[model samples]
Every structure is written in structure tokens, then in C-alpha cells.
Target: MQPRRLALANQKGGAGKTATTLGLASAIAARGGDVLVVDIDQQGNATKGTGIVATEDLVTTADLMSRAETGALERAIIPTPWDGVDLVPSDISLGNIESDGSNDLVFRLDMAFEGVDLSAYDAVLFDCPPSLGKVLFSALIAADGVIAVTEPTIDSVEGVQNLITTLEGVRRRPNPRLVLDKIVIGRRRNTGEHIAREAELRNAYGDTVARTMIPELAARQDAHSERKKIHDFRGGRAVALQVAYDDLLDELNLTSSRVQEKGA
Candidate 1:
């Protein structure tokens, strides 16, 4: 099966983008699928959280950006601590990649992921930056789909409208095949505001809003503090996250071999 490349994004902070990326990647890989997580966030939370922080310099995304000349992207693909998973870890250099690889900008990521065809891997997840920056655009242009993460707030929804506008503009010219797989709602609460927001979102975006709701669980924060996924940690908090994200994964179709290949 052809790999599904998802640029998981949300310009706003605290939208559970990082947590979702880490949790889903691990959960999906644990199901006997080969996974490659491409992190383009300068903060490198995904890199640290996934235990690839020590693999800096040698095969980091920054090193690939430095030598995009040879059209060697595989050099950046690093084997993570997990057997079924790998990482295209990122650092601060991800921000400078666009300007650095100016002439080769359009095909930079495509060129980097050249040889090791994604068909072999079950999924390719791009942990995007928190802004509509260079790294975010590059991933959007290169990926098969974008999993837009959103919080239960009017402000975040407003940002999605703007993001969609920007994406629409890009689709008209640059990446013609870009598709939004689904917009995952993050940090949900049973509060009145959150309840109202969810209804508004469904009415606003219709089928784009996914059925799963990632509840506002403390486990997400607790897991982050330890640099471990919620599923990998112990205690009741960990169990809560597993239940919440399990519903999410089921909605995302990651629990099965079936996957919707965007831009197919």
C-alpha cells in the first residue's frame, strides 16, 4: 500500500498537535506497521519525545537541509529507538531550510524522501511548526494530506478559516494535489463554551470535522513532562489518555490496515 503522508498541523499552541503526533505514531507503529515521523518543528518536541534527541548532526533534518545539493534526502531519515518506526528529526535549522534551499525549495522534501519509497512504510507523519512558516508550507506542498488540529475555541476556528484560505491560494498554484484529510478537535472539555464551539464547527465545516474528540486530559501534560507517550506511561492518567486517543485512532483509521490515500 502507498504510504499516507499527513502534515499534522495547527498554528495555535496547546492544540495537542505534538501529543497527538507522538501518541498516534507510537500506537500505529505498535500495530506492526513501519512508521516514519518527520518533525519540522524548531522546538524539536517530537524529536525529544520520541527519544531521537541524541541522533543530532549525523542524520538530522538540519544536516539534510545543509546538503540538499546531492539530492540526498534519505541521509536525513534516521532510525528511531523503535524497531517498526523511524524519524526524520528536525531542529532549529528547519526554519532556515526554505531560504537555504531557495532554488530547490519546491522539491526539497520530495527530493530528501527519494529512495526509500514510502510504499514500504505504513504511515509518514509530519509534525509541523506552530506557524504558517516555511517548514509548514513545505510539508503541505509535499504531503498527501493534512490533518488539521483544532482547539475548542472561536479563535482557533477563525485561524482555520484563514489557514484554509492560505491553503486554497497555494492549491491554485503550487501544490495542486493538497487535501485535508480531517480536522481533529483537540483539548475538548464538557464546558458550555466547548460544547457550543463543537456545534458551530460542525455547522461551519460540515464533514471536515472528525468524529473523535481528544478530551482535555492531564495525561497529555504529564506524558510530555516525562518525554514519554501517554500510552507508554503508567498510572490512571496514562489509561485515560489511551481511552481518549484510542477513540481518536479509530476515527482516524490508524487502528486498521485500511487508510484513505489523499490526493490519490
Candidate 2:
């Protein structure tokens, strides 16, 4: 089966885009699914979280995006410390793509995947940067769908809208098949404003907003710092985060199934 490529993105920073990517990947891996996490962010937090240190010898996301070699994507795939999870890791060098003036830069990622069989994996997750730029555009161009991760704050709601606008622009031309699969609310809190904003997002997006909300728990940070999957991490509220991600994965599976059924 062709893997479902998902771009986890939010133009605004601190929207828990990386956290969501790792969480979902971990959840999928725990369920016996193989996942490829392509870290398109310069920070490389996802790469580190997967316990793969970026190095000069490794073919990183920059190489995969910039090089036209037919085997680049295949060669970039490396096993992470976590079983059932692979990575196309990134580093600070990936930032150079933002400054490169190549006209086909946005299409490079799509080109890199051409003629490659990704059937070995159940899903491919792209960890996008926190900006609406070439990297984000490249990811969207290559992805089958997008999961816009945001918090339930005023700024985050605006960020989701900006991402929705960007997705619409991309779909109008380059990726007409791309869908906004989900709008997930991450880093949720019990604050009155956050509660109100959560209700507001649910009201506005209706079914598009995910039913699973990732709570504001320090365990997520601790797990990332220790380079352990939240499922394996024993920290503050780790089990709760794991359960939330499991629910998110179920929702994602249902969404994918519906899309497949519609296509059929």
C-alpha cells in the first residue's frame, strides 16, 4: 500500500507541531505500523527525539530536498532508535534551503519521491518548520494531506487560519488532491481562555477539529529530553499523553479510511 503522507504544520511557533508529529509517530509505531518521519525543520527536534543525531555522514532532509538523484529518498531513510520508526533527519544545514534561489526548490521534495516505493511504511510524517516558506511549501507539495496542529489560544487560532489559507493556495494548483485532514488542538490547558478558545475552534471548524486534544503536560517535554517515546517514558502524565495520541491515531485512521473509500 502507498503510505499516507501527512504534513504536520503550523506557521506559528509553539503550536506543538513537532510534538504532535512525534506523538503520532510513536502512537502508530506502538500499533505495529512503520512510520517515516521526515524532519524538515532546522531545529531537528524530531530527529533528536527519535535518538538519531544528525551528522556529516548522514543524508539529511536538505540532501533529499535539494538533490535530484532518484535514490536520494531511499538512501536518506535510516532506522531510528525506536523500533518501527524511521527518519529522514535534518540539521542546521537545512536552513540553507530558505536562502537558495532555485526556481524548482518547492518541487524538489516531490521530485525526490518520484519512482520510489514507500509501501514498506504505513505512513510518512513530515515535520514542518514554523513558517510559511519554501520548506513548508515543499512538504505540502509532497504530502497527501495536512494535519494543522495548534493550541487553543487566539494567536493559535489565527495560525490555523493562516495555514488553511496556505493549504487552499497549494491545493488550487500544485496539489489538488491534498486535503486538510485534521486540525488538532495540542498543549491544551484548563485555563478559562483556553477552554473558551477550544470551544470556539470546535464551533468554527466543526468536524474538522480533532476530537482528541493533547493536554498541557510536562511529561511530553521530559520524554523528548530523554529521547524516549511517550509510550515508553515514565514521567508526569505520560500515560495520559499516550492515550491521547492513541485516540488521535484512531481518528486519523478513520479519516484516511473515509478518504480511501471516497476515492474508490
Candidate 3:
């Protein structure tokens, strides 16, 4: 079965891409859906966030990208400490691999995920690098749709537009079926300024900006340091997050799964 891949991308940094990716992947897994997180960033923040240690001993994306056959890549897939989730972790070697002129980089990642059976997983989350590079293109080709995370600010909004243009350009060629299904405005607040920004984004991009606005909660940030997901403890954070993710999935008519209870 073709796995529905989602990329949490933004041209600007600190748009909560990593946080969104981790939360969604973990949430999907918590709901009993098997999930895989591909850490495409050279920084390996997502890898670190998931507590994947990288001291050069482990096989990583670097090895996979350079290999002729993805046998090594599939071998590198690690069942992370996270339940119902597996990872093709990133590492420092990723810095040496440039997407600028790689030979067929787009199809490269696409093939990496091919052999594996994605039927059990409800989704595959690609934590993309913060640039328009081979990794993003590759993820786009593999993904059925993408969710661009934008903050409630103008600079971030501008970056979001540029990202869309870049994706549009890619779709014109290698990823003709690629659909940037929705733009997510995360960390929304109740201030008048926030409302205006949201309105502006809606006016600018129309309905592509999803109706689900993830509220900024202190606990969401707190969960990070604990190496825990916001979905774990119930309350405002979990309810709001669940609503946003479920709304996005509903918009796409996608199915959700239930994972065994944590530590069961």
C-alpha cells in the first residue's frame, strides 16, 4: 500500500516544523498506527528529539543516500524507543551529502521507502531540512500531500509563499501529482494581531490554509525537555492538538489508527 507521507516544512526556522512532525508522528502511533519518521535535516534535531544517539557508529541516512542499492538503507531503519514508530535516523555525515547536484535525489528517497510495507503505519512523517533542496523534492515525490507550517508573522508568511512556489516548481516536473494539501498556521494566539495575520493568510492563500489553528500552549514546549509527547498527558494541549491533526486528516479523507496504550 502507498503510505501517505507528510512533510512539516517552512523556509524559515522556528516555525515549529520539528515539533509538529514529532507530535503528529507520535500521536498517530499512540493511536495504534505504525509510523516512520525520516529525519532529513542535516542538523539531526528530529533525530535528537526522538533520542536517537549519533556518535558515528550507527548506520544513517548518509549511508543510504550514497549507496547504489537501498539494502543498507532498509537495514538502517531502527525501531526507535517510541512505540509503533520506526526511524531512518540522520547524522553528521549528512552534511557531506549535497542535494544540489545529487544524481536523481528525488527518486532516491522515494525508492528507499518502497520496499518496506507501509500498510501497518497510518502515516510517514518526513522532517525536512529548512531549505529548498533535494531532500524536499524527494519527500514531495514520495508524499501524497504536504502540510506547510507557518507562524503568525509576516516574515514567516513570506517564507511560506516561497516554499509554495518551490513546491509548485517541483510539481511542474518530477512530482506532477504532488499536492500541497494544506498550510497550517500553528501557535496561534487570541490577540487582535494574531487574528489579523490569520485573516491575511486566508485572504492570500484561500482555503488552502487549514481551519485548524493549533493554540500555543506552554505544556507543548514543556513536553520537549521531558522527551515526551504532548499527546501523552490529557487536557487542553492534547485536545487541541488532536483536533488540529484530525481535522487535517479529515480534510484529506484519511483514516486514523489506534496504537496499544503506552507501556502496555
Candidate 4:
């Protein structure tokens, strides 16, 4: 059986998309399950977060997107320092693909993975760019589902709605199998405005909003800066972040056993 491919996305920057992607990958690794993370964001935050720096010699997602062939992804896949997690790193050059005029440009990402076996992974996650551009569309076309990550803020809420609209379009044509799996509330704070916004989203999109809310904790950034998984990081409330990601993994049914159960 093939693992589920999901895109963690938000049209707004600072919505914790990369953090959530890495956190979930870390949680899966902690459970002895492997995951493949494909970084399609120009910022390369997810690439760096997984402890792999994209040197000029490295084969990246940018290269994969530029090609129109199969069997290329295997060579681009590299093991990360994080156990049980591999990555297709990305760099700023990915931004150039956005403006390409080729008619089949958006389909290249899915084509790149054709005939490749992904059963070794529990999940395949695409850390998408913070925009509804070609890069994001390419990921949506290739993915089985989407997890929209957003902050508990007005602008972020609007961004989630925009993402939903985009998903509807993708489903109607390019990728009818694509589903919006969940809306994850990330970087949540205890402030009054945040609390109100969170309530608004839950009431409006009930059940689709994940029950697990990722708190705005400094340890997340600290662990990222140190290039260590939150499960291994030891200070500044890292335990809280770790528990949240674990809960999210369970909620999403992303564990290998849980995924098998679902398929059964």
C-alpha cells in the first residue's frame, strides 16, 4: 500500500506551515515510522529544519519540478539527520518555476514521482509555499489531501478560506482525489483576539478543524534553530510542543498502524 500524500499549506506567511510539517515528521519518526518531506517552498525552511542544507550540488525539488519525466525523484531523495525521515530539499531557485510558461508545468511534480514506490513511508508531506501560485498548485495536483495550517488571526482565517476555494477548483478538474483533510490551528496564543478567532473558526468549520491546536511556544523555534527534533529538544516547554504534534499525528491517523487500519 502507498502512503498518503498531504500538502501542509497556507496562503499567508507566518502561519506555521513549515513548523507543522516538520513537527509531524518528527512525531512519526518518534513512533518508528518513516516519512518523506518534499519542500516546495522557496524559503527552504523545511529543508533546513530537517538538518539538511541544500548545497549547489544537491538535487532538489526545484530540479524535479523542472523536468517532465519519471524516476527522477529517487535520486533526489536523501536521508535527513532526523531518523526515519527523508527529504527532497528546495532552494530559492524554485521560485523561477512559478513563472514558467509551459502548458504542462503544473503536472511535472506528479509526473516526477511516477513509477516510484513510496510504501516504505508512513506519509509523504509537501511543505508548500505560502501562496496560491503554480508551486502550490503543483503540490495540490500531486497530493492526496491537504492540511491547511493557520494562526488564530483574522488574516489567517481569510487565508484558510482562500485555500479552501483553491482546493475546490483543484478537485473539480486537475485532481479530483484531493481533499482538504483538516484545518490545523497553529501558533495559537491565549490572547483575547486569538481566543475569539479560534472560536469563530471552530464554530464555522466544526469537525473539519483539528481538535489538536499547536500553541505558540518558543521551544519550537529554539529546536528549529538548533536543528534538533522537538522530541529530542530539552528546554523551554519542548514537551508541550512534542505532545501537541503527537496528538496531531494521532488525530490525522498518520501513524503506520493507524493508516493500515484505515485502509483495511
Please tell me which predicted candidate would have the highest lDDT against the true structure.
4
Error of 4 at 248 (Å): 0.4
Q: Rank the candidates by lDDT, best first.
A: 4, 2, 1, 3
Q: Candidate 2: misplaced stretches above 4 Å?
A: 254-264
Per-residue lDDT of model 4, residues 83-195, tens digit only: 88999999999989988989998998999888999988999999999899999999999999999999999999999999999999999998999999999999999999999
Cα lDDT tens digits, model 3, 100-190, are 4667656767776667666666677888888776666667777777889888888788889888898888789877877887888888889
Question: Which one wins on TM-score?
Answer: 4
lDDT for each candidate structure: 0.74, 0.90, 0.74, 0.93
Residue pairs clashing in model 4 are: none
Models ranked on TM-score = 4, 2, 1, 3
Off by over 4 Å in 3: 70-73, 234-239, 246-253, 257-264
lDDT of 2 by residue, 82-106 (tens): 9888999999999999998878889
Lowest summed lDDT across 10 adjacent residues in model 2 is found at: 254-263
C-alpha displacement of 89 in model 2, angstroms? Answer: 0.4
Candidate 3 to truth, TM: 0.87
Q: What overall lDDT, based on C-alpha atoms, would model 2 receive against the true structure?
A: 0.90
Predictions: Cα RMSD each: 3.8, 3.5, 3.3, 2.2
Off by over 4 Å in 1: 54-56, 66-71, 98-101, 258-264
Clash totals, every prediction: 1, 0, 4, 0
* Candidate 3 residue pairs in clash (backbone atoms < 3 Å): 31-258, 31-259, 32-258, 32-259
